[model samples]
Target: MASTSGSTRPSALIGWRVLALVYDLWPVVAMWMVASLVFTVGYTLSGHASRENIAPFSALQWGLWLVCWLITGAYALLSWRRGGQTLGMRPWRLKVVAADGVSAPGLRALMLRFAVGTASLLLAGSGFWWAWVDRERLTWHDRASGTRMVRLAKR
Candidate 1:
């Protein structure tokens, strides 16, 4: 474990960030499954047939997508608020903090980070690749949110 005690922590590299994202996918998928189950139950209870799946591009399907998004965001925001790391980040000793590298980022910043990160993914990770050329080695989300991901030294 790493302590958020000093300003000397190194910024996390793209590889570490990608690894954490991959690891985080497991829990996120689990959450999405649970959300899907709830939606399925609600849909069935609303007089829909038991075997019917949410129709593609229908309003109900869109609502389910939105719910899943919110659920994922809640998982991320709450984890970041409670501690600087998510389950995946903990393994890599990655911590999210203010740009100065020692304090927790505010909720607004975390939200911004999440939004931009989604955009980054949608754009085929151009924003993440930008870090390779950025002077500060920051991704779009990091800059937009005024947050930095640091790799803490091993204990």
Candidate 2:
């Protein structure tokens, strides 16, 4: 990991970072809903349509889970890889970038961000709160993925 000590890059504050996440959730949810519909149809077609079998699902449920996971991950990945800004990040003037704070992140880095970020969120946002006390003010996803959410200068 590169030490960003004394770097002049402006990292987004936690509040702005969170709000951008909130903004991004809309599309993620929308995409997940679509993925869920497909999963439901697939499950039904797989001869598991019976009501009694639906509640206590088999390990095959992981298929649906993975599909939804990929749907959301693709959203974050493409946005960061293409322009470094998701729709949510734009209004807030936020951009997701590599540790260098300039280069756009590649697929591997973006995937790490999504996986670690989801884990962070699932942990009652402890990873996010870590920034409050971190010397560099970086969240777990940021540090783990070597990516940063930077605050852009006003246009």
Candidate 3:
């Protein structure tokens, strides 16, 4: 266990991280639905028939996807910045902090963490798996962003 702020806590393992992500997915999906709805309404108002779905692979469809991604990123960045943990992480007692294990990381580091985490997911979670073998049990994003996730002690 690592000590931080005069308390002993373990670095969050892969299992905890995966569980938190699964929980977080619910809210992200909800955000995606709202973004899709907005895009659909805009598409209809822009001369497309109300009955028509955005054509697959169309530029508009791609833009909608990008918007969804940005919205999800905003949700994560804001949550992490405002508090060390997101809703998902709260149940699991996971908190993100600087590598030194106390201070909140800056926005740049958090953005790096989010981007690298996205890539990790896109790569089928190889970056996350790396934590299993890491000496410090840190994921790629944790290393890249100079941040770490710790499992807080029970209250």
Candidate whose lDDT is highest: 3
Candidate 3 residue 7 C-alpha distance from true site, Å: 9.6
Winner of 2 and 3 under TM-score: 3
What lDDT does the true structure give each of the candidates?
A: 0.88, 0.81, 0.89
| Superposed model 3: Cα runs more than 4 Å off | 1-10
Q: Give TM per candidate.
A: 0.90, 0.83, 0.93
The C-alpha stretches of model 1 lying farther than 4 A from their native spots are 1-10
lDDT by residue for model 1 (1-155), tens: 12354544336878999999999999999989998898899999999999987788999889988988898889889999999899899999888999877889999999999999989998999999998888777899999999998888768
Summarize candidate 3's per-residue lDDT along 49-155 as a digit string, tens digits.
Answer: 99987788999988987998899889899999999888899998999999888889999999999999999999999999999989888999999999999887778
- On TM-score, the leading prediction is 3
lDDT of 2 by residue, 1-155 (tens): 22234436446778988899899999999998888777677778887754534454656567777877888888878888889999899998888888887788778888888899999999999999898888777999999999888887766
The candidate, 1 or 3, that scores higher on TM-score is: 3
* Regions of candidate 2 where Cα sits further than 4 Å from its true position: 1-10, 47-53
Global CA lDDT computed for model 1? 0.88
**Candidate 1 clashing pairs?**
none
Candidate 1, residue 123: Cα displacement in angstroms equals 1.1
Query: CA lDDT of 139 in candidate 1?
Result: 95
